[model samples]
Target chain A: MNIGTRSFQFHTPAVIIDQHTIAGPLEKQGNLTAEIDQFIPDLYDDEKTYELCYTKLIRQTVNILMSRHPLTTYLFTGDLINQSTPTHYGLMETLLVPVTFDHACATFGLSLQSAAFMLQQGQKQTVMVGTMSHFAAVEKQFRFPNEYGQQKPPSSQTTVTGGGFCILATEGEGPKITYATLGRVINAGFKDPYNMGEAMAPACFDTLLCHFQDCQVTPADYDYIITGDLGAVGQAILFDLLVHEGYQVNREQLIDAGCEIFKDHQPVMSGGSGAGCLSLFLLSHGIKHLFKQSLKVLVIATGALHSPVALLQTPIIPTIAHLVVIES
Target chain B: MNNKLFHTVAEKHNPPRPLLKNCVMSFIFGGVICAFGQCISLFYLYFFDFSEETVGDPTVATLILITMLLTGFGVYDKIAQIAGAGTMVPVTGFGNAVIASAIEHKSEGYVLGVGGNIFKLAGSVILFGVFASFVIALIKLILT
Candidate 1:
């Protein structure tokens, strides 16, 4: 049933049957190394290009799931590339009708929600959701080429080079998909690409309020209330805004995937980021935290829905946050 | 008010940006890059037996080639990350930038992807650089 705002309450069960996370060498060195399904030894991974490297990461992840479990009915996925063509073209041979959407980092979250909705309606018995981001490719398209050697400010996040996939079915012996609270684009008048945390923090706060009010739940309800890519600076801004809005999120439970992936000393300025950032962490390290029939999580996957072309005309970066509940 | 709140929060977590640290690192790296070039020129004069006047072109070409290889190997970017402006001032920086663009576009294939897009970042620099130098040299000739 639809809730008070842009949120849903799924009465029937949509459980994750299988999952795979393939991290690049850098992410392997990060804190979540032990939980990752596979550690790619190099950025190229024997491919001629970064795009092909990204495709291989996702393809291998899908292959692992297919080789072990029942085939998912459809595949939903995306990446940070322009038109998401590289990702779509890469997965075309899989023969699964591909659904590609780009809400930036929130692509994974939206994919899961769409898959869960389809499962609830009995239109699809099972669905596979996946996403990937290659650091160099993303650098050329979104910012300057890495070789350009421009100094990005300290607030900027390093887009992770990784991929993750999850297969959810109506019948499974795992965590159940519960609710999805869709977010609205909120701009707080911050205009620096280098300081993206501030640009996206208000949107996170707005979505959190919407989820809390519409779902009639508090922070204590979930075992973990994770933000997609808030990083260090954005999380602090979000925490302050939440307190100002009269909502006290559990400091212990309210963590960010961006901060969790890398170690403290790692040179990742703010934290881990990209479309793969949240999913790789969630599907790998996060799932381990879920004891069967014990843990509940709310993943608020956030995205800054701004293009370089759009930024030239306006000094505003609009942001969105999509939240989904999972109970194990 | 809200802006104040954002700035305050952003400032609180922002580790003091070490301007002096960047300057020192840049100076050291820039010196190292130049010293490497000097050694190459000396090797060309002594070993290759090239004349002092002819050494300029070969030394620069070698520096560019070396930086381009470093760019391909992803070492230049890491150095640039730490060395900052020091890496950008040398001719090696330009070489690294072009090779990086080429590598990023390699997936689109060599024709339209690598060949056409290689200079998208550095094209303007080449254009204005040659143009500006010609104008400055013309003015100098006129003054003389």
Candidate 2:
């Protein structure tokens, strides 16, 4: 049922039955390394190109999720690659009808919401929601070459090198996605692509505000309200915005997926990002915590919707965020 | 909040770029690269029959060759990151910009990928370089 202008409360919540995650060498040394299911020691993964390696990552994630829940009737997946080709190519042999989405880093929440909506309609029995990103592939497409030596600011985020997928069914014994709040495209007149945290923080805040109003719950109600790929810089900006909006935000409860991936020692500047960043965190760490405790969590995935071509033409980097409330 | 007000808040959170540090690093590294080029120029001058003016061609060629090798080895960019515009202001940076794009687009194929994208970044540099030189040449001719 529609809760607000952009919010929806599912009659039948979609349950995440099982999840699998894969990480590359750098991520293997991260704080959530123990939670990751598969580890690829090399970024190349013996593939000729970075795109091919990303395709392999998508294929592996889908295959693992399907193996666990073979009854998966639909696939919702996306990535940061051009036209999301890695996702399409990766799922080519799966023989499942795939709906590819592109919301940059916010793809995780979009896919999850779609899966939940499909399940709510009682049309699809099981849906596989997945997202993956490769540092090399994404860098080549969006920024610079893997070997191109360019100094990045402290606000810049390193793209995570792996991805995650989960099997969501109408009836399952796991955390249930109950609410979704879709964010409007927000441009805060910030033009620095290097400082993506600032560019995307406003969108996250916009979505969170809508979510709080639509659900008629405060930030104190949820065990956690996690933002996707916001990193340290973005997280700080978000907290400031929350305070500005007169919302009482618990610092501990409001965490970020980007901040959770890498340890403080890692030289990832602000933190890890990409479509995989949030998915990896949710699948590897967040979902597990849901089963351990009767927790109510909100996952807000923020995406920078500007392309290199558009970035050069315009000064503003528009962003969007999608919020999903999962309860156990 | 309005975009203007929100921007102020966002900007406050974003740490300012370390301008002084970047300048110092760029100066030192750029000087080192130039000194190395001078050493290569002296080597050519000492052993070859070329004069001072002609010696520049071989010295530049040698620097570009070295840059190509370093870029292929994936080490130049690492150095450039610390050096900032130090590596980019020189001819070696130009070589890297071309070769790096070529290496990155190699996946598409030799003709459409590598060949087409070889000048993806450097094409602007070449165009502007020629245009500026032409403008200067015309000015010099008129003055003469």
* Candidate achieving the largest DockQ: 2
Q: Please provide, for model 1 over A1-328, each residue's C-alpha lDDT reduced to its tens digit, 9 standing for 90 to 100.
A: 8999788989877788788888888888899888888888888889887777877887787777767655665888888988887677776666677888889998888898888898889887788987888877787677887666666667889888886888888896888889988888777777777777777787777777888999898777778788889888898888877777677666787789899999988889999888998988888877765435488888888888888878989878888888899888
- For model 2, residues B1-144, the per-residue Cα lDDT tens digits are 477767778778878888999999999998999999999999999999889999999999999999999999999988987899899898888999998999999999999999998998899999999999999999999999
Q: Score the docking of each candidate (DockQ).
A: 0.45, 0.71
**What TM-score would chain B receive for each of the candidates shown?**
0.88, 0.96
* Model 1: fnat (fraction of native contacts): 0.51
Question: What TM-score would candidate 1 get against the native?
Answer: 0.90
Q: Distance (Å) between predicted and true CA of A141, model 2?
A: 1.2
In candidate 2, residue A300 scores what lDDT?
Answer: 96
lDDT of each: 0.83, 0.89
- Each candidate's interface RMSD: 2.5, 1.3
Clashing pairs in model 2? A149-B77
Residue range A1-328, candidate 2, lDDT tens digits: 9996789999999998889999999998889877899999798999999999999999988887788778777888788877888888887888778888889999898999988998999998888887888999989888987777688888899999997999998886998999999888898888888888988998998899888888788888888889999888889888988888888888887789898999999879899999999999988887765446898889999999999999998877999999999998
lDDT of 1 by residue, B5-122 (tens): 6666666666555799899999999999999999999999999969989999999999999888888877888888889889989998888778888977777889998999899878
